[model samples]
Target chain A: MVNKFSIKNLDMYYGDFQALINVNMEILDKEITALIGPSGCGKSTFLRTLNRMNDLIEGVRVEGEILLDGENIYKDIDVTKLRTRIGMVFQKPNPFPMSVYDNVAYGPRAHGIKKKAELDEIVEKSLRRAAIWDEVKDRIKKNALSLSGGQQQRICIARALAVDPEVLLMDEPTSALDPISTLKVEDLAEELKKDITIIIVTHNMQQAARISDKTAFFLNGELIEFDETDIIFSVPKDKRTEDYITGRFG
Target chain B: MKKKINFKEGLIYGIIGVATLFTIGILVFILGFIFSKGLPHLDSHFLTSQFDSTSAYVDVKLSEGTENPLGLILGEMTLKEKGSIEKQVIVVKDIEKTSLAESAVNNKGQNLAISKNDIINRIEGENVEGKSVDEVNQILNSINADKVTLRITKQGGGIFPMLMTTLMMIGLALLFSVPIGVLAAIYLVEYAKPGRFVNLVRFATESLAGIPSIIYGLFGMILFVMTLNFGYSLLAGALTLSIILLPVIIRQTEESLKAVPDSYREASFGLGANKIYTISRVIIPTAMPGIVVAIILSIGRIVGESAALLLTAGTAAKIPSSLFESGSTLTVKAYTLAKEEANIELASAIGSVIIIIILILNALSKLLSRKITKI
Candidate 1:
């Protein structure tokens, strides 16, 4: 398998407080990698670093190299181009207060796709890939907020997919959803990893074990273990990882 | 537990109900008084004519032998004249038989025998010679056995010019202020760094909103009317009004912009959209309903404003031929009519018109906000 992202000696700080420290890992292409940890353990922070989303926060300092396809994202790639290649779905279901069609088309429209037919094709295909086309096709012209929470989340997923990014970053995307909706999103993620590399930060350990091919256990701003999902769940090398998976401690 | 009477709640509810009723009662009473006093005077003629009263007169004489000769002549003239002669009246100065016969040759040089009927027919026919009422009165009074004057008077005319000027001022003021206010708000909310400078700017904006409008009027008079040399004109007035409206627009726009969810911005940025694009497409559209409400309220303020406009836009009482031309808005006209002319009826009529405009604007803002919310 080809490596999609290579992180070497990454350290991030928010002013005086260090959020991520000396983390190193390789994310494989076309695979679901899950990062599991307790709250405030820097899992979400590490996910934001992939696309430089942390740069939006004031006084954020980073010292490291995060290589995407052998190009240094911080030093070489423009932020806009970098973000275009790496799309993020926030924890909350945030569909823009517009029509579902417009919500799906927002990414393509931003990237300068002016042709209506092309946008129509992309919106439809993205919605289909997110497993929501059948439910929302009739009401595509309606405001996205008018839909139920699960439907809205799926529309958000479709919106992220519309940009056709190579990597998808999901930050606890199903935490706000019900059981059925969570399963739907997990299935969609499983299907999406066939074509796009996905890095998901999930609080639910079962969710991490179920969907991820590779799992990385993080605790207190440090990555304790990184291995295949089955090995991490069945026989973790580190005591902390084993304790966390077995619910002995976070 | 036994069911107990909630006397405290009842007392509070009664007090609230009375207060609400008191407020509504005052409004209804004021509106009722204004409409009753003003509606009768608000006719098509009052709406369409000028603002001055004028009267015209013509004089004539009568023979002595005829019974009620003055009344007969007026009745005959009314029947023969093409226009309404009801407004015109004939005043007989004298009645004498000898002088009438001697000056029997009418002003038209037509000979008339010494008969009352001939004189009446001549007066009713084209024998009267004079263009203006004053000239006719002079000639008829000069060669008189009996002299009469035909007088016609028209009361105060309409407020058409004032209405036009008010509309134009509103358009111009909005044109001047909306863009600057909205852009300033965008800068404050979206672009400015959270530091002392931005906080200072915010503090200054809030203080500006609290300052009295009369101070703004004096400032506008000095700045736009004198320094800029726009003079006492609609352009000057609009410029002044725009300054007065700026703080309101900025505050409201800033509030609405701040109300936009950060998630929208995040979504837009995640799609690789630039800040400008995201603001223009997502933020502005989301805040538009609030902005529109602000604009509508500004329009209401413009409609009711008198003191500021009076200093900048002189009370010319005519339609402004250009932006630089002096004119009076509805509020200014009302103020002038009540203060200078003491025409309370007309002033009340103008007040009612202003109230109607504000009510319509209020309704429009509500409708628009509801519509935009649905979208």
Candidate 2:
């Protein structure tokens, strides 16, 4: 398997507070990697660092190297281009207050795709990939906010997919969803892993073990352990990881 | 179980209700008074004519030692001159024979008959011929004639020029203020860091809003009218009004921009869109309804503003041919009518018109906000 992202000695700080310490991980292409921890464990912060979404926040300082395909994302890449190559789905569904068609087409339109027919194709294909085309095809012109929460989340996924990014970062994308919607998003994520690498930060242990090929355990801004998902669940080398997975502590 | 009433809560509610009713009552009473006094006089003629009555003056000479020297009663009578042409001329309705000037010649060197119902188109040696009615009246009045009759032909009543000036002021003020104010607001809300300088700027804007509008008028008079030599023109008045409107526009626009969710910015940025694109497309469109409401309210302010315009826009009751020319808005015209001319009915009519304009603007803003939210 080819490595999609390589992080080396990464440390991140928000002013005086350190959110992520010296962490290192290699994310493989076309595989689902899950980061699991309790609340405020810096998993979400680490996920944001993949796409540099943390740059939007004030007083954030990052050090060390995060390489995408052997190119340093921080030093050698434009932030906009990097973001286009790596898309993010937030914890809550945030569809723009516009038509569903417009929400899906916003990314491509921003990137200078103007022709109606071409945009139509991209919108339909993206909605299909997000597994929401059939449900929203009839009401495509309606405002995206008018939809159910689960449907809105799916539309947001379609919006992210419209730009055709190589990597997808999901920060607790199912935390705001009900059980059925969570299952649908999980299935969609599994199906999407055949093409693009996905990095998901989830708190649910069963979810981390179920779909992810590789799992990384984090505690207090430090990476405790990283291994194959089955091995991490069955036999963890570190006592903290074993304790966290076996429900002794998080 | 029986529930007990809280005295404090009931007292607070009673106070609030009375205050609300008091406010509404004052507004209704004022509107009722203005409409009742003004609407009867607000006709098409009143809206379309000048504010002064049209008058024509004629000089008459009485022979010495004549009886009934002041008995020559004057009335407007149409007479047919050469070629069967009919024209409105001030003629003598009743004259004593002893007051006749047999050798009197008209200004045209033709023999004049001092009989009753004779046409008096000109006065001797005054050069009143071939001049406009206003000039002729002025000349006739300047002569100090002992026997002159002023004949009023038309009543001055219209507010057309004032209405136009008010509309133009609203347009020009918005033109000057909206772009600068909205841009300033965007910068403050989106780009400026929350620090000493930004806080100071916000404080300054708030202070500007609270300053009396008459002070703005004084400043505008010194800057635009005296220094710039605009000389009490519509442009000067509009510029002054623009300054008065700036703080309001900036504050409202900033509030609207701040109301836009940070999630929208995140979403747009995550899609590789630049800040300009994100703001123009996502943020501005969402905040448009609020901005529109702000503009409408600013227009209402412009319509009702009088003191600042009175100092800058001179009270010229005529249609301005250019921006440099003087003009009067509805409020300023009403002020002049009520204070200088003491024409209460016309002033009340102007006040009613201003009220109607503000009501329309309020309704329009509500409708627009609803439509935008629906979209």
Q: What is the interface RMSD of each candidate, in Å?
A: 1.6, 1.7
Task: Give TM-scores for every candidate, taking all chains together and pairing residue i with residue i.
Answer: 0.81, 0.81
Residue B258 lDDT (model 1): 90
Each prediction's DockQ? Answer: 0.45, 0.45
Poorest stretch of ten by lDDT in candidate 2 chain A: A241-250
Task: Please provide TM-scores computed only on chain A for all of the candidate models, following their numbering.
Answer: 0.98, 0.98
Superposed Cα deviation of residue B174, candidate 2 (Å): 0.6
lDDT of 2 by residue, A1-250 (tens): 9999999999999999999999999999999999998889999999999888899889999998999999999989999999899998988999999999999999999999999999999999999999999999999999999999899999999999999999999989998999999999999999999999999999899998888999999999999899999999998999999888888876
* Pairs that clash in candidate 2: none
Q: How would you encode candidate 1's per-residue C-alpha lDDT over B159-203 as one tens digit per residue?
A: 888888989999999999999999999999999988998999899
- The TM-score obtained by model 1 is 0.81
- Which segments of model 1 are wrong by more than 4 Å? B1-22, B44-156, B368-375
After superposition, candidate 2 runs with Cα above 4 Å error: A246-250, B1-21, B48-155, B366-375
lDDT of every predicted structure (CA atoms): 0.84, 0.86
